[model samples]
Target: MSNLAILPILLPFLAGVLVAFFHKNLIASRIFSIIATVIHLALTIFIFMSVQESGTYVLEVGGWEAPFGIVIVADPLSALLTMTTAVVATAAVIYAPKSLSRIQEEFYFYSFFFLLIAGVNGAFLTGDLFNLFVFFEVLLMASYGLIVLGNGKAQLRESLKYILINLFSSMLFVTTISFLYSVIGTVNMAQAAERVGEVEQQGVLTVIGILLFFVFATKAAVFPLYYWLPSSYTVPNAVVSALFGALLTKVGVYSILRTFTLIFNYEVDLTHTLFIYLAMFTMIFGVIGALSTNNVKLIIAYNVIPAVGFMLMGIGIFTETSIAGSIYYLVHDMIIKAVLFLLIGAVTYAAGTSDLKKMGGLIHHYPVLGWMFFLSTLVLAGIPPFSGFIGKLLLLQGGLNQEEILIVIVALISSLGILFSMIRIFIGGFWGEADIMDLPKQKPSLAAMTWPVGILLSLSILLGVGAEMFYPAVSSIAEYVMDPELYIESVLKE
Candidate 1:
């Protein structure tokens, strides 16, 4: 079990190397990428089950001990997220060959894709803060390659902005890590957690905590810091865009969860209160952006910001039920965002533009695509009988329990705006008369593209239907995350 913690990160790194050798053969590269992700997914499942049965698993690199040498830790939270990353990455690879241009496939697309996945897995499973920063760099570098894969003017321009913003965030992350290490003399998160509890200069620690919060919040695309996201995301092709929309920002939120729940938790009263307010602004601003955009990709991209806010709200509420709801929502959003981005990509592919005004009555020919878009929109809006509903309900219950009436109200109203924003896209892009006479008719392969969307949507539904069974597991993850002693013991013990 301890050894398995390294497989998720190692498989992808090795696969990336193997795929780089076959980059000229798109078919071989695609096949290799898919197989690698499938194996990673299987490994992640085994890790998840192992963590469930045994509590946590830690792998000390080179047999070096914790608080000194590198370690990989797979607690329930990391295991769940690693499994989700594998699932999403598998779908992206399966969808890639069809969505990517031939040049992209022939180049280093698959190589960088696996590199990105490896970095994400490493970020989730690493036990030390400095290594987490290292993984972030790995993923960000790979994303730089993937974002500008085709080298179009729009892709290059937007990719520059994405790169610059992340570069700045990376600098901030390093600075925060330095400050933290200077204070505690350790980068291992569990050890840092132990030292934080014993540190007497909590006022300085509180400032460091706030700085760390800002660093992670930037990656998560929280308000003010999120200006780079919608534009950066909308410029990429749907496959890359969908993958970023689904996974990247969530890693930031996951980092926030790890930091606030473990190392920097000495000042939750001060720190969590800030999260609650920022979450309110994040949701409101995100909805406003969605309401203002008629571009299908931009609307979907903007929605990702608010979903981050919702998860943060759960974190800020800081209850087991609320955190569990956030974890469940995180899983649901990964599937839903992928579906929405892919579906929108198909629409724009058919219509030859992302502008909703240029697209009309797509359902007349592609009824399956239209309905998938419609239902996924509702699932995103937290409609009843969908997975979003249960997660939102638990978050709201947590807010009410904490007497955060205003936060609850903001969340409720934001749901209305979310529904409105998505419905507008549906009516304009799918329901109106076909105005696409001048556009070229090179539609993407429906069977190829739509099947992946269908698979993701099915997962979304299953998350809702199976919530009764899954909730307990996420609840346990929440409990484990909130109390870091179990993680410390598991990682530090000889």
Candidate 2:
């Protein structure tokens, strides 16, 4: 079981190497990528089941002792995240051939895609802080390649901005790790958590904590640091945008969750207060951006920025229920966001434009695509019987439990904003007079592209309807995360 933890990371890395060398054939590359994703998904499920039966599993890598060599750990939180990453990556791979340019299909797209998966898997599974940083860079490097792969002027310009911002953040990340190492004398997250309280200077720890928060905030597209996301993500192809929309910021959020729960719990009250305010502001700002944007993709991009705030709000509330809500919402947002982006991508492919102002009456011609878009948009807006509704209810319940009146009000406002923006897209893009003449005579392959999206939408519905099962799972994860002594003991013990 301990050995199984490594497969998710290793499989993608190995597959990437093979694809980079020998699988230049698009068919072979696609098959290999799909096979790799399927195996990773299966391994993730097995890991989740193992955790369900026996609790968290810990493996000291290379048979070396923990706190000296690297370790891989799979608590419920890590397992759930790994599973989510695998599912999303698989869906993206399955959907890509239909969406990617023929050049991209033949070149480095599959290789880089698998590398991105490996990086995400590494980030989730690593029990060491420095290892997390390494994985983050790996993901970023691959993203840089993908963003610039098409070589359009817009792609080049936006990719440069994205690369520069991320590079700066990477530098800050290195500084934070150096300071953490200087203070704790170890990069092992479990050890850091154990010793963080005993560090000589509380001020230093606080400063480091804030710096690290900023680093993640930038990566996660939080308020004041999110300006680059919409513009940059808009430059990529729909398939790339959909994958990034689903996974990238979630990785940052995941890092923040892990770091806060494990390493920076020394000043919970302060961190909680700060994150709460940030969450409120992020949600407000992101919704406003969505409201003002005319481009459908940009609206989705802006919406992604604020969703982080909602998740962070749960983390800030810090009750058992809030933490559980945050976990559930994290998974929920990942799927819904991906589905929406893919739908938008399909819409753009059909219309040759992303501007809602230029699109109209698609429902009359492309009923399947229109309804898919409508359903996904509704789900994203937190309509009932959808995953978003369940997540929002849990988060709102947590806010009420804490008597956080301001947060409750802000959350309500955000929901309204989401609904309005979604309505704007639906009414303008799908419900007006038929503008089918401007669109391509030949539609993209709906069956190939739509099925993966259908799978994601189904999962979202299943998560919402099967809340009885999921809530217990989330609660168990929250409990494990909040108390992590068992994780520490398992990893460090002889």
- Supply candidate 1's per-residue lDDT for 397: 94
Model 1 weakest lDDT span, ten residues long:
435-444
Best by lDDT: 1
Candidate 2 achieves a global lDDT of 0.86
Model 2: lowest-lDDT 10 consecutive positions: 435-444
User: Model 2: which residue pairs collide?
Assistant: none
Q: Give lDDT: candidate 1, residue 140.
A: 92
Alpha carbon deviation, residue 4, candidate 1 (Å): 0.4
Please give the CA lDDT of all the candidate structures: 0.89, 0.86
Count clashing residue pairs per candidate: 0, 0
Return the TM-score for each candidate structure.
Answer: 0.98, 0.97
Tens digit per residue, CA lDDT, model 1, 1-494: 48989999899999999989878987777777888888888989988998899878889999898878999998899999999988888888888888878988887988888899999999999999999999999999999999999999998999988999899989998998898888888899888889898873388888888888888898999987999999999988899998899989999999998888887776778889999999999999999999997899999999999999999999999988889888988988988888888888888887778887777888877889999888898899999889999899999999999999999999999999999999999899778676544644664457788887888898888888888888889888888887878888888883
